[model samples]
Target chain A: MKDVYFMERDPYAPIRHCYGISKILYEGKSKYQEIQVVESHYFGKILILDGVVQFTEKNEFFYHEMLTHPVMFAHKNPQNVLIIGGGDGGILREVLKHKSVKKAVLVDIDKDVVEVSKKFFPTVACSMDDPRAIILNEDGFKYIQDYKNEFDVIIVDSTDPVGFAHVLTTEEFFKYVFEALKEDGIYVGQSESLHYHLDIVVRFQKALKKSFPIVDLYTTVIPVYAGYWWSFSVGSKVYNPREISREVDVETRFYSDEIHKNAFLPPNFYQKILNGNFKY
Target chain B: MKDVYFMERDPYAPIRHCYGISKILYEGKSKYQEIQVVESHYFGKILILDGVVQFTEKNEFFYHEMLTHPVMFAHKNPQNVLIIGGGDGGILREVLKHKSVKKAVLVDIDKDVVEVSKKFFPTVACSMDDPRAIILNEDGFKYIQDYKNEFDVIIVDSTDPVGFAHVLTTEEFFKYVFEALKEDGIYVGQSESLHYHLDIVVRFQKALKKSFPIVDLYTTVIPVYAGYWWSFSVGSKVYNPREISREVDVETRFYSDEIHKNAFLPPNFYQKILNGNFKY
Candidate 1:
């Protein structure tokens, strides 16, 4: 057996995180990006796309639960939800956990990612066959533009804001997301590392402020991510993302009602970060 | 010029975070540990000891501020302070910021760690010559056994609890620390990462629980550290480490009153982690 390792380099920063690989479960490319399913030395199985780690078996709940629950709990009743680019189905699994979610539409451009995830990561892709899930193999950028006042919550779980995926974070695309949502809707997307990509975080938050009344940034410690301080940007029409409208009633490893509130940056700290007080 | 990279392989896990190096400022070994001061491509100068990153110029504030302030503010009148193994002098600089601190003594096993830091990291080592500060080069494990009811606060800023440093975290050593502190004293040490070394954290906190009435864990995101979510274990005799005794009147980049409270894990989340609720 040959010793193999996966080098997860951050294009935004001059650093990388390396993971020792025990076995390569699957390796192939979709029409849009490269994909791989590798059994890791420590973190069980890992899903990698375009040279970036999407999640690991041991740590998927941190990213999935955070990306899903805050938005779901913030909305009064998330009867309908839109998940863009979550082809791995982790977000869809979390969204369906909400009793209020009548339908969850997951629009991902890469069919191979979903297929490989369903094949290699059974636990993460466990909820793909749920009746409430509506999987669409199309670009969410185009799919979101077709709906009007449809989704109660919209979550962009796409790759980094680069290449073709860049459109998901643009102001025009934000307009599409705002229009696709109901009058009182909540929106969120995984931004870059808060430490490495402050400029992008500020830019994304400022752009969302143009279309939404409430905008905020929250962070979590992702073990496999480049900086470990992975961030999520939130935009809400009426409700504050910091306040939870629903009590947590789902099975989760990381998300609790208290962790939800504590996860968001304090107002003064957030303002200071936006004001460029941080030199790092 | 060659492109050099610093591979910080975590001894606890089969993972490493790499930093691109622009220049090597210093590389040598003291009697205690191997040391290096290097200029990084994105994170400015970094101080490395025994293949582990102590702090980087770009993001030292997050670690230093987090390690210093909560214990400082938790005490009503923090007049006498003791620091064990903070050779970089970053903790000394923050400790000197409090007007209430009348005397601060720092003891380390390696003099080279202090010398190289003063030469290459002048900003971090700026307060070395303070009149009220005392610098001693000795093993803190042995140096701590000499005092009884002496200091208001005691902090251990040493390397990871490995090799010879392991003794500093033992229950016997914690008993020594308890005897060295005043009736209303506080103690804090750099525990392992919350994400990677939960077992070590639990063990250290459990050990501290035997010596102190109030023992808790706090965390902050350190970009260059192994897991990024660096944690500190705190034990106090009288004061609740969560409350602030004095206002933040010092100049700091990251520690504020709200962040001081926010840096701590929520009580329920902390309990859940202790109860083994989280998988990651």
Candidate 2:
């Protein structure tokens, strides 16, 4: 068989990441965006939304684990956990691994993304049937406005901050997130690539710093992403993700006790990034 | 001007990185390989050897600093340093930063690679003519066999472990390297990408472990590299690269004392990688 490549062009970056596609397993347009499930020789199944790689079966764990467990393990008692915009169920799967988590709520506005993910990615969408997971097919921003000091940990797994997910990275949304969290709640979100989106990361940190007492950044390499050095921003009322408060007895290939401590950028990186004093 | 892209294809990985090029400044067939210097709108000047990108002016510091300083700082005093196959002189520039380093020698077999770099990449090749820096255009393997416990630090910034550079990553060459370093000396080399070249990294580490008592891995991200998580293998007789023995007082855009400590992999990663106990 000849080869076919999917070129995922970044909106602003001067590079276009090309992925080899073996076959198109499923292709259809959702209400908010076009969706496709494709088979890759190296990466197994890949989920694409609006010509952007959402995740692949081979390395989704890097993105999902880094985004989920750091915040989950940071809090001393993360009983009530909330994941925003992770319709793919990968975050839910990771969240359910925490024994301390009593109720895990997942909120995504796009119901079609959830339906498609459930139909195509069974292993990645594995935790949908778990007893503790609560699914909400509604706008997370509107849904979050009604709460006050509710969740112990809140994670935003939204797409890049250029679309409907744009509001989620704003000061107003962070203020809403501040109101929705407990006195000691921790908020974590994908802050995009630190190499390509340093401006966006600093913006997110600045906005979160207004509401949360502690804000820092950590990153992991996801091969599918353009810059590969994908960043995750953390906002906490008390816990600093660089230091884990709880002992991790969970099963994870990438995030270990050492990795948790090592994943964080040194204080100098945050100083340079947040203060807009650095350049790539 | 119309846009042109330089497509970098890895022999194994499924992805081909595309960088936007403004113009091809020079193209010629060297005695050993074909070389081209191209100007990029985003990455400044890019040096490509035989269709593979050597370094771009934009982010070479990420690679050069990580490969050089980890071991350089780990050594209490690195008076004499030797570099193998770093024709581009990025490593030489970083080696001269240490105040303790008195004599820095760079040996690359390809004279054209050095000549081309000196012409097109003046800023990156800035330290090639420094009083303390020495250039030797000769076969490194032959030159290395003459030394016995002479150099304080030896760095192998060779190309990927393919073609002529293959010999540099073998057990035999590591033995030569082990014999060439003083009792308290340190060694470092680019071990390729962690994601795409895990087996190569493990193999290099395993080989170095035979001759050196302490061997570890460190990495930095390069956007030009297929896998942005680039790995550098360190072998030392007395120094542990994770902890620095000397204070770093260099003017760098990327490397700092915090970065020096942060660049090395956590102990768990080394354990998992060395035992071949993990998979991506």
**Most accurate candidate by lDDT:** 1
Q: After superposition, how far is residue A175 of candidate 2 from its true place, in Å?
A: 0.7
Off by over 4 Å in 1: A1-3
Worst 10 residues of 1 chain A by lDDT: A1-10
DockQ, all models: 0.82, 0.78
Q: Give the chain B TM-score achieved by candidate 1.
A: 0.97
Candidate 2 lDDT (Cα, whole model)?
0.87
| Native-referenced DockQ of model 2 | 0.78
lDDT tens digits by residue: candidate 2, A149-255: 99999999998888788999998999999889999999999988877778888888888888888888898988888888889989898887788888898998788
Error of 1 at A115 (Å): 0.8
Against the true structure, candidate 2 reaches a TM-score of 0.97
Which window of ten consecutive residues has the lowest lDDT sum in model 2 chain B? B1-10
Query: Clashes in model 1: which pairs?
Result: none
